[model samples]
Target: MSEPTRRPPSGAATLRADKTAAIAEAVLDELAEHGYGRLSMEAVAKRAGVGKSALYRRWPSKQRMVIAVVSEPTVALADPPDTGSLRGDVLAALHAVADWLTHPRFSRILPDLIAEAQRDDELRRALALRIGEPRRARMIGVLDRAVERGELPPDLDRELALDLLGGLVYWRVSARGAALEPGYFERAADMALRALDARPRRA
Candidate 1:
């Protein structure tokens, strides 16, 4: 006698990872093109080549779908590498922020999401919870290590540090539309270090 394998009562979402990934990407494209205020489940389904029902099965609403999909790349880039020294760590953080801000469709999608959230209180809160908080918490790890290494003051303003860490880069790329030139990463890292009053590691 053989035993039958039990499956999810809702069916095999786990088996449709590729389809889910495609849908997520489709959502990004739609967001970049139409903005969150204009995005529709049908548009995403058409772009993804999946039925509208497929989306509903995964998410109860458009906002839920957007947050879940957008949060993937946002959260994935949270943890910067431990480069030992505060300068190295700051440089790493700058690089990570740059990477996320300039990501293909996400670069455009993010700005749209931000614009839409500005007018919608609920959307803003959802973004903060699903995307902002997780990313902020991960970024705090970099400053925490600097504090432990005695490179930063014990009373370091970590939230402020996080702001200054990615602020300039975000402004330049996401707002000012400036290209990242050679040495820009180092310059940004140095500026953040200055802002944080970081003590450089002794050579």
Candidate 2:
């Protein structure tokens, strides 16, 4: 009788995870080097040392793959630290934003992606839905906590507050090319708190 068919090793799960991570890292590098407008699945697969089929197995399209690879880490890194005070929380959030914006790979990738998104509706929507919305929700939670703690008004304009926090850092670091000085986040936090008219809790 024929022997039982030899089964593949049980390492498939681990192998898949490793390949996924490799592909993600390769995607970032490709985007940083080539920008979103020039990125291709072929390039990413070659960079990752995987077959193009490996990428297609994971993501159905280049847009989906790029968005997932970029947005997952971004949203993960964007978890605002709960410092139990609006001022502290604001500083933590801004610091995280500064770190990401100045990161070597992201610093290169983001500006190009932003420029491309301006002209590509599909890309714009993917960025908004995947990266923008999650980050905004987190910031809104930060503001909601501030309100609960009586540190901000119940009717605070969360959208404007988000704009203030993100805009200040983006303009300085990404747009204007200014260096982040020591205590920059603290100073920005103070300014943001003042702008939002944040108040101290009552006994």
Candidate 3:
């Protein structure tokens, strides 16, 4: 008789991938509802419809899980299209920031996490390292490309430029609760580029 047909190993891998995705969704929900300070693995497991052991299998601690869940989205959203010009790139990057800041779930979770991070040194460090630095680096790369293309001054203060770009969006969308109008991203990019290109006023 011919050998019996054998099942491929894909079943277990697919199940694991589904479970991991479910856990990530649960983490966002838990963070939105409870804030990072109050999030718990048991609660996440319950939310995900998976046992706590599944969580432990994926992450050794609550901190690790939270960092992974939050940072993955943050980094992924930091990516900006080249767009062939500094102005276009700046607008694109600002729009990305605005979108993330104003996202339904993140808009709530981010401010709470920032507040909690102020009191929690470890959490602050993790966020800065995993989310803040990577996002900033990408923005810096945008500026670098502009300089290489002769669109921006080589002596441009890239760090300050990134700050202005990010700070404006954060303040308007996250802090001031201002809604981004149809041309807001374009207008903001124009203003930021003007500021970046402006020469220092001598007394």
Candidate 4:
């Protein structure tokens, strides 16, 4: 008789992934409601409808759990919002990010995450990968599309241009530690466009 077929535990893995996702969402809500200083593992576990041991099996500390929750992948932009020009593209992206940050939960949670990052290298690295790099890449794609269409200078330093565009939003967020006002993104986009499109002034 042939040996019994060996099978991977795909169902178990799927269940674990689903449970982990639930835990992460619960942790995010707790962090948003109570802030990191006051967050409790037991509360998150209870809220997620999982046992404490299960939460502990996945994450050993509140810091790690919070990092995982905050770094969850965001929804992609809808249709890339082409307005037939580079400035329009930049404005669209800025508005998207601004709208995300304007949410009460995100605005409250992000500052706590940044504060945690200052104290924890592992969390900081995770944030850089899950949040920082992806955001930078998306902005770069928008700029590259503009360059390809002759909307922006082909020789423009894309990395610097991305920084010029993204850094302004981060600056306000990090500095003010509050929800951004309307028109803030538009103003930042205007400034970034001027910087990117400026001509060399004749001396």
Q: Give the per-residue Cα lDDT of candidate 3 at 81.
A: 86
Task: Work out candidate 3's RMSD over C-alphas.
Answer: 8.5
lDDT of each: 0.81, 0.86, 0.81, 0.69
Looking at model 4, residue 55 earns an lDDT score of 74
Clashes of each: 0, 0, 0, 0
Please report how far candidate 3 places residue 63 from its true position, in Å. Answer: 1.3
Once superposed on the true structure, which residue ranges of model 4 sit more than 4 Å away at CA? 1-21, 57-64, 75-83, 177-185, 198-203
Checking candidate 1 for backbone clashes, the offending pairs are none
Predicted structure with the largest TM-score when compared to the true one: 2
Identify the candidate with maximal lDDT.
2
Looking at model 2, residue 169 earns an lDDT score of 90
Q: Which residue pairs in candidate 4 have backbone atoms (N, alpha carbon, C) closer than 3 angstroms, thus clashing?
A: none
Model 2 pairs whose backbones collide: none
Q: What is the lDDT of candidate 2?
A: 0.86
TM-score of 4: 0.74
- For candidate 4, the per-residue lDDT at 185 reads 67
Cα misplacement distance, residue 193 of candidate 1 (Å): 0.7
* Candidates in descending lDDT order: 2, 1, 3, 4
